[model samples]
Target chain A: MKNRLKVLRAERDWTQAELAAALKVSRQTINAIEKGKFDPSLPLAFKAARLFELSIEDIFQDEVTP
Target chain B: MKERTTEAGDFTACNVKNNVRLLSWVFAWVVTLVLADKAELYEWHSSAFISIAAIVINAAIGLGVIVVFMRHLKGLDELQRKIQLDALALSMGVGLVGSFTYSLLVTAKFVIDAEVTDIILLMTLTYVVGVIVGQVRYR
Candidate 1:
């Protein structure tokens, strides 16, 4: 999975720590999601979507579409 | 004054307490083992009460470690918890197979001087490896 988390964060001029605090997760988790090293769980993804006021599909995309 | 974070990667306030508790658990294990060894070697068994006290102390320390370990596991995030669960499962499987193999060899009259401590050490090593493998797979 790929996500536009970095772009969204950058648009808001938010640091990873700031975003993580809002999302109730550690900064490492945000970094991992941004780097594509880790995929967030559904609840976390929903939290991120709610935080950014965007749909999950708008934030995340499948790397290999069916 | 600012709160200090230990090198264990616990960022939350609750995690700080958990880290300190974990450190105390390790300290207690070392102290209990040393005391137990001394009790066994020296003449601490001169009194039945003293002997029983030592055994009780050892058991209490072991139980404390287990309790603290479970609490620490409960505090992990979902992904980390998954990794730990998988690691524990793999380690347990390896430990059982290794112990069963050694027991069979012992039954076959093979002269193996392995003790329970050796099995415990092997299991610990296996858990460490399992955790590393899980982390690598996720990373």
Candidate 2:
């Protein structure tokens, strides 16, 4: 899975720590997700979507599918 | 977001408190054991009080450590829990196989001087390695 997390966070001027705080996760988790080292679970993806006010599809794309 | 941050902060604080408490208990338990061992070795077989105290304190501290560990595990996210479970399973498998192998070797007279502590240490080392491997696999 690939995601626009970094771009979205940048647009909102939110640091990884700030985003992690918002999501109730450790900063390492956010970093891992942004770096494509780990994929978020559906609930976490939904949380991110809610945070950014965007659909999950807008923030995350399935690289394997394409 | 603000509410969630506050919750996270609280969780971190709680984790730190639990960690500190657990460490303190373990430190006290180890110190007591060392002192007791030293007294026993020096022919200071004074009273059964020291032995009893050591046993009681160690059991209490061991229980505390387990409680804290379980609480910490319960607090982890799903993926984190899966990684930990995998690590634990791998460690247990290694521990069992290594113990049996060592026993067989001893029975065959292929090795000597193997003590119970060696198996405990081996299991601890394997568990640590398992944790590292599990983390890397998830990452």
What TM-score does chain A of each model score against the native chain A? Answer: 0.95, 0.96
Q: Which candidate is the best by DockQ?
A: 2
Model 2 achieves a DockQ score of 0.32
**Each prediction's TM-score versus the true structure:** 0.79, 0.78
Runs off by more than 4 Å, candidate 1:
A62-64, B1-10, B135-139
TM-score of chain B of each: 0.81, 0.81
lDDT of 1 by residue, B19-94 (tens): 7898898798878888877887886667778777777887888899989989988876666777789989988998
Encode model 2's per-residue lDDT on B1-139: one tens digit a residue. 5676776677667657766776777687777767777877895777888777866777777787788778777776555666678778877888899899999999999989989878878877877788788677656
lDDT of each: 0.79, 0.80
Q: Which regions of candidate 2 fall more than 4 Å away from where they truly are?
A: B1-14, B36-43, B75-86, B132-139
Query: Candidate 2: which docking quality band?
Result: acceptable
Worst 10 residues of 2 chain B by lDDT: B75-84
- Model 1 clash pairs are none
